[model samples]
Target chain A: MQSDNPTAAILVIGDEILSGRTREGNAHHLAQVLNATGFDLREIRVVSDDQDQIVAAVRALDGSLGGAFDLLFTSGGIGPTHDDITADAVAAAHGTTVVVDAGARALLQARCDRMGLELTPNRLRMARIPVGATLIDNAVSAAPGFSIGQTHVMAGVPEVFRGMVDWLIPKLPGGRPVQSLSVEVRRGESDVAEPLAELAREFSDLSLGSYPFHDERGWGTNLVVRGLDAARVAEAMHAVKQRLAL
Target chain B: MQSDNPTAAILVIGDEILSGRTREGNAHHLAQVLNATGFDLREIRVVSDDQDQIVAAVRALDGSLGGAFDLLFTSGGIGPTHDDITADAVAAAHGTTVVVDAGARALLQARCDRMGLELTPNRLRMARIPVGATLIDNAVSAAPGFSIGQTHVMAGVPEVFRGMVDWLIPKLPGGRPVQSLSVEVRRGESDVAEPLAELAREFSDLSLGSYPFHDERGWGTNLVVRGLDAARVAEAMHAVKQRLAL
Candidate 1:
């Protein structure tokens, strides 16, 4: 089905990210992955470990996809800690209970044996999943993530979460191919602002941006040309640099 | 005034971030900032340029604070692009029209002139403020951010956003003093897991975490002790390390 609009959203769950205890780099990493696989990054949110907040965020993001968002990615709060409530919330949002799936339990048990840790009552919480959800393997850690409907829920730990996301995205159906082009210049965004606006209008299919950065030579701009087509981005980038005379 | 529950949330707005073009580190930076300042981070979200999403996110986050949060900080969407709709949505949330406030105008004009940009109709859009709001000055960038009610809106760029958040938060009354202690041992999280959990239970007021990282013996754990009181954290860390015989 060739849909006119294809988008994706990321719901980051945890009190840590919300409180700024951990600076998140996953959103950017996921954004790159989704862009390459062809999904319009529509929205990204960080909600705490509150079940109600997670449910609200998940439901809202799922609804926004309008059946066109090929996928919705959620990161964090899937651990054994008290604050880790994403798994339960995911089940509740889809009107299900947290059940210990057979495969998930097997993975956890193997990891626990390898690590020589007791699989306590709270640790069992890691095996819980929503009904009819498929497990996403976490090679780096014992806990596994899952995908129910179009929502892909994963871990909060950056390396594990990104590992799952990278492995799982390719197996699903990708709707569009994300594309980008960039040219760095030694001029303020405002200096070449007028031409940038015109170029954006000229290449309406491409989303153009003028990012100004400082590197000793006063200020410069990194003009990025993004779109679905490679040729269009290249054309726009060339035009932008020529117009700006950089 | 000191409050019982110091609440906080982050509202990240941008298409670049949502689409995965730009990686967002602001959420994590802000989280660490709030934790160090002793504010309880409740929720964080990244919405796109869509007006409805922004308006809904702000209203919900505003309601969540309920005069309990020390502050609600936001980053991104304070630009002069067509997709920049945060100002308008913020005004909608507050029951006001997006108007050019005098203070905002002066700041905007000064920035535009400093950056050598002509204050055009489009450029002036960055100056549009929700009525009765205070401006957060951007030392790195000319575009000044704003604060309405408790939501502190700043730029999306990590450096600029972090600078603005640092300026805005310390101005408010910080509720709790943060405390932390660390001990690195030549063992994996598994080797010292039991003792760490036992110690965490003993100190109800503190949070103990074991982060496994690179070590000369292959893998090592960085035992972290966090709490509101410095004395308790110190005592707990000392006991935990001794008990584990590390």
Candidate 2:
């Protein structure tokens, strides 16, 4: 199912997330957006803001570890605070240096001027971009994200991350969009496991997933079939309904 | 900061999460539980329900990839459906085989009898356990999670996962519980970055993190101090507030 589609991964760098001080939202949002845009999101990893960890994750997700991804979207650690070390870590991973980009600095200066705030040295830290990287526009905040190699570094704040993703996704290459069909049945997953397995074997090219839900009424399963081919996905959905006798 | 605490990682195995069909809650719940239990939650990885991916993540989180962890907790992929291949994957990662444990089968049988459902082969799939693994009790559901070596695998359902965690945390060895103090200031993170960095440098032993938030009112920053020593954490918080004039 993934062989034909371009694969992507997410690297969420934040101690607040790891400490459970903040609930991770950017990864989930990216997952949905990538899925809709025809990218297969293979993995999502959350690591602390530690430089070594961030660098290792960047390399690992960028294909130095094992399986490689076509794109790696990183969230968090792109702010002005001392803990925002994503730019430097990404630069180290790509064997480059962090430098202040003229465009980014101008944008920060303009934002500060508009807000009636000083463009202090601390705020200037947000202008640091990885060498040889293209600036990713952030409409919400002036401090722009950047893309060095296949990795796209974004801010940790949800609004800024969404804005960056919106600005970045349209520029990247996409694959055939996948169509999904879901059938909800109020039955235990075990009761339908055999038939679902048979259907999965029959439709090997499609991704078949069984998600169980429990509510006050009873147990139920949401069987979903996803494929790049719309006709095949529909055919598989019909077969699933028939096989499950729903 | 991590040297004194037992480091733990979470491996979430579910295509639903990666495909954006479901929001990931187990990892966040486990993160808070592990944090409160004094285990340093180092990393969290979300992978699809593919067997190879699950095996790779289990090994990676268990220290075969790069950095090793003291504990690894896995969520999802232990259901009766065909996609539930976590037991087999974990066994393969450990170079073992999945076998139906007698105790687990009995538990499944009792649950089936109570629900007045047939214990078919598909239903019996839930009894499969990794070799040499001890069953982790699941009070919400009949099927039990299991622990092999340092890896403890649990359910994906939030209620079941929480129950299993409640039953499992007390059994694991814990380190000094971390104390965290937060000082919220109605200022942008960049406005306080300099003082925060100074405070962080002064309290090098403690972990200081600045999290920026944006709401309808305006921007605000939460400066958090976390350390094993409660007094040190409090002192760092005080210095952070004083230096920032919060």
Candidate 3:
């Protein structure tokens, strides 16, 4: 039987990241948070803002990943601007139509009225949501993100995106947090690989990785041992140190 | 006739990044450098260190995109460790065999000699290169990266990766560098969406994007205009401001 923990994928939609105009802002944050909350972060994809590309990417992540992940988080392209087409693309991917959801519209209307700004037709675009979806609150900005089925769409701006994630992550089910430890070996990674592979086979329950790093001191390998059980992770790291003579 | 500038994609091969243990280190650096040097970065994908995933990613980017890009740069998995499977995956993707290249072995030997370390078999793992590929020098660390066809492989370490990029970028053919300008509008993106869309249509040749931000002052959108022609870019920005009455 599968564990109760859910898997997740992050789809970053933006031309800025592709053009090197902006460094990634939201995905990393989400990754760290998801790990701490016990959800598995499976994949991250960065695509341009083109509609077809966005729709295709959504379907590929949602459909072809073989239901491996329980939730999909998308950042960027949900704004009111022309380039912000994430909402429509998600709708298209799910074979649904986007409409102005009452909750989203009410949230936007309250925010606009409080700011003494008229809710122009263009501004109202932010209220549009795919039918049969729930609004994800945006504390930083009034424009709410929405979750249609398993896909969640949010703003690209870091602060707003973080807010939405904070608001939504707790509602989802999660497994036990993964425990990990690292052992720094003086020997280079290749020198350790042969034995490391043996250790990996012995510690089948633990996920082991050898990270080769070259710092000012010299090149060395950091052996990382991770598992859902704290005791198993500690035992694996202890065995790694003993086998590698660390 | 098509512009002379080349297009590129960055493949980040690592499990740490996908697992949120480490943030990305090199892709942003490459993106900025590529843009300044006139190459267009079309996409970036972060996949696990699994060989199948690495090979599939390489093929997908190099093959499926209709040769949409001219160069493929990969980082990580070139170390002497068991998880360092990038070199073999790259070779597999190209249907080539990985053999110990004499030049790469010499480079590693010299560095090992200088450092007074034994050239163990594990250490020599770094010398294995795809047949018929040219080695990319790693000034910081002696283990060099390699290039086969249009695919360029480099170390995952930040310093070595940047050094390899600096050495290789100059030799590749490049088009005119793109010019860009930013205009901060004191209005919400939705409020500016209509006119902005019109301005974008008018400046079809230029790539324009509206980025919404929320700071202490309030929510506003930064309009970015970019193009190869400097004069056209300025003209487009001028018309943008004029049309928006900013």
Chain B TM, every candidate: 0.86, 0.96, 0.94
Cα RMSD over interface residues, candidate 3: 1.6
Candidates 1 and 2: which is better by TM-score? 2
Error of 1 at B137 (Å): 2.3
Better of 1 and 3 by lDDT: 3
Candidate order, TM-score descending: 2, 3, 1
Q: After TM-score superposition, what is the CA distance of residue A67 in candidate 3 from its true location, in Å?
A: 7.0
lDDT of 3 by residue, B165-237 (tens): 9899898887788788999988778778998888878888778899888888887888998888889999988
Tens digits of per-residue lDDT for model 1 on A1-246?
A: 122446788887754455455566777888888778876777777776678988877777775434324568998777664445688888888777778988888887887798786776566778888888999985577778999877899876677877798789889777668577888887655556678778877887778866545544666667778777788778888898789776
- DockQ for candidate 3: 0.65
After superposing candidate 1, which stretches have Cα over 4 Å from the reference?
Answer: A1-5, A63-70, A80-83, A108-125, B1-5, B64-70, B107-125, B183-202, B205-223, B242-245
Model 3 / residue A41 / CA error / Å: 1.7
Cα lDDT of candidate 1 equals 0.73
Candidate 2 lDDT, B66-133, residue by residue in tens: 43687899999999987899999999888889999999999999998998888899878989998899
Q: Model 1: chain B TM-score vs. truth? A: 0.86
Listed per model in order, the count of residue pairs whose N, CA or C atoms clash below 3 Å is 13, 0, 1
lDDT: worst 10-residue window of model 3 chain B: B60-69
- iRMSD in angstroms, per model: 3.5, 0.8, 1.6
